[model samples]
Target: MILSPYLILLIPVLYLIGWIYWFLKHKRPSLNMPRIISFHKISNTPELGGTFNTVKQFESFIRFLKMNGYKTARIDKILAEPEEKEILIFFDDAYENIYNEAFPIMKECGLTGVLCPVAGYIGKKNLWDRGLKRFRHMNENQLKEMSEAGFEIISHSMSHSDMRRLNKESLIKETTESKRTLENLLNKKIDYFIYPFGLYNENVKNAVKNAGYRAAFASYNEKNDKIDSFAIGRNTMYIIDSKFDLKIILERKPLFLFGHEDQKGRIINWFSRFSAVIKI
Candidate 1:
């Protein structure tokens, strides 16, 4: 059957619209000093967790950040100097793959990042590995080596559970115990907590604060203006996408701040997942 002329024309228009929408969605713009930027997970292998793996991609991202004049900082460093141009990176669960494959390159690039590990999962089979086929968490010795290398070791919950689905007691235990365990292992102050699965409610936030953490990180694409201290927003750097997406992210400040204003980040989360599936 022959297609109608209008339908053929409309197909190109739809494709163009989709392309432009994605182009704007992932673009990163250049900025001057005193800005906050961050990336997560620099492991050699990708997991079910949303992360950008691959040493070459990570190196390219580091070079992209450096070219844009962004400076990397440990989570504690960014918290200490909130006004400074800070790029706080978090490697959730502290996979040993990063130390084995990505650490040397990161150090050579002079990029520092936060390493948030599941306190109880260290030196054990991670839940992701049990069923998801992802790599295991880093061992205690690896965590120590990273700490000595200037990476801020922080909390990523005890079991990587969704805080929004947990009871009050469980939430408290996940936050408090993870912090305590990391502090004991590192022999240093652990003051930051990154919510696992980027899922949390007011109760979880309060639990984190009560657990003696100075700040908590969440997965929201918004510029933190000191008001969202406890629930600081973060932008995910996805794999299998062009670096141009970074340009879109940097340019669209208002989009980042209010992208989830209506649905409260659910839409953004969905879009990111869709992008990943389509290799956007």
Candidate 2:
């Protein structure tokens, strides 16, 4: 077998051509849907996951919404209202950065976000994920401050465990008990559920609905074509996402353009099944 050094270069060129062809030939659709973007952490420091949106990225996102005339909806997230341009920024895991970093940035933009806190891990370091990322969940007082200031507080389950395999009793504890914990802590009715690690099934959805939540959101597992209240999908923002990627998503470009990132997230979710026995 004879190989030319130029062959290696030609392979990349071909891939580049294919990528360009695929990107341009596809028609990008501006979806008339609710803008529900999800974020995990707010920091420039690197972590084991791709979910961090640097402080600058967070501020830019809020500013982009404000400059584009996007308003933060104050009602229950997509429960009663028909789809509109109203943006609902969702901060999953309720990292303290949401309070120390993202809260003021959003407040300055005259916007607020939906904060999903793991009820059991409030004020404690996240022990749910497979690693000790040392990420701290917001404390009770911080959560109350945001709630009082108009941020929606909801449950990311009780312990941030993988709930898809739980029995009815344990699932109820994860569902209803978490909601009750949040409501009791915030002194407000917790109206929605954000599944832990965005992992859920029909039984999991049933657990959420049976818990009396109006809707349940699963992160990074949705397409705009169908919006399910119980299985609503959220677009997750990552540190590696380019500014152009953010622009296309905000403009509602076709999901295929940047949706591979989401598929990666789903793969991460599957690996979380080992969180109980491993620490990576």
Candidate 3:
């Protein structure tokens, strides 16, 4: 069937309206400021509740951020120069596929990222997510290579367990042991801690600080206002997120375009808090 001239003419008008709506909803006047965001997996793994982004998609996404005048910087740099407009890319869960897929693309783009690996599961499969299909974590050598190549290697706890549920001794071990293991393996000072499952509380944050971490990150979908380093918020990225989704995050827009915590996320968080209260 052939379209009428009037209908064809209306197509562009409709496109313009949609574009304007997107701009009004997502544009950030303070876009030229520092921000922290995160990604996980960076692969198309078919697992329940798993977050990922294919290699090609990430490359284009990175390009889009740079094109929009966003500079990719490490966490330290962003902290040191808060006035500069930069984006800190944090990757949670050290998956081996990241070394094969995302790492190369990041190197090609002259960009670097922060990888938060579970110390106890290094070179092993993720056993925490029992129901979902498991995948291999990055090995010691891969972690070292990444560190040497200018990537920031950080900790995501000892075994990806909920920090809030951990007793004082267990929480201390998770924070201290993981930091020690990573520092020893990389022979570098590991200063940042990433809250596993994005679940944390005053006790968990205190444990991280008492463990000697300079800062910590959480999966809160907003920017950290230099309030408390231990509970710094981050925007999470997934395989489903497109370049537009990422742009909304990097821009620090008014809306939560991506990585909003869902029911499962809330359940894990609630369980963690409740278990901690009962001292379980």
What local distance difference test score does each model get?
0.66, 0.75, 0.73
**How are the candidates ranked when ordered by TM-score, highest leading?**
2, 3, 1
Error of 2 at 127 (Å): 1.2
Screening candidate 3 with a backbone cut-off below 3 angstroms (N, C-alpha, C), the clashing residue pairs are: 52-239
User: What TM-score does prediction 1 earn?
Assistant: 0.74
Q: What is candidate 3's TM-score against the reference?
A: 0.77
Could you estimate the TM-score for every candidate?
0.74, 0.82, 0.77
Residue 136, model 3, lDDT: 88
* Candidate 3 local lDDT, 1-280, one digit each (tens): 9999999999878756755554454342344334776766666655445366677777788777666776677778776676445778887888898888888877877788889999999999866553245678999999999999999998899977777888999999999999999999999998999998778889999999999998888876233323456776666666566676676666545433322322223344455335333421
Question: What shift in Å separates residue 48 of candidate 2 from its native position after superposition?
Answer: 0.6
lDDT of 1 by residue, 28-55 (tens): 3224212333444455555443454567
Model 2 misplaced regions, further than 4 Å: 1-30, 75-79, 82-84, 130-133, 221-223, 254-278
**Regarding lDDT, does 1 or 2 come out ahead?**
2
Clashing pairs in 2: none
lDDT of 1: 0.66
Tens digits of per-residue lDDT for model 2, 1-280: 7889899789878766754554454323336445678888898766665567789887887787788787888646444573666778888889998899999888888888889999999999977554435789899999999998999988888887778878989999999899888888888998889887777889999988888998888765354455677877666777767666666666654555454444444555454444533654
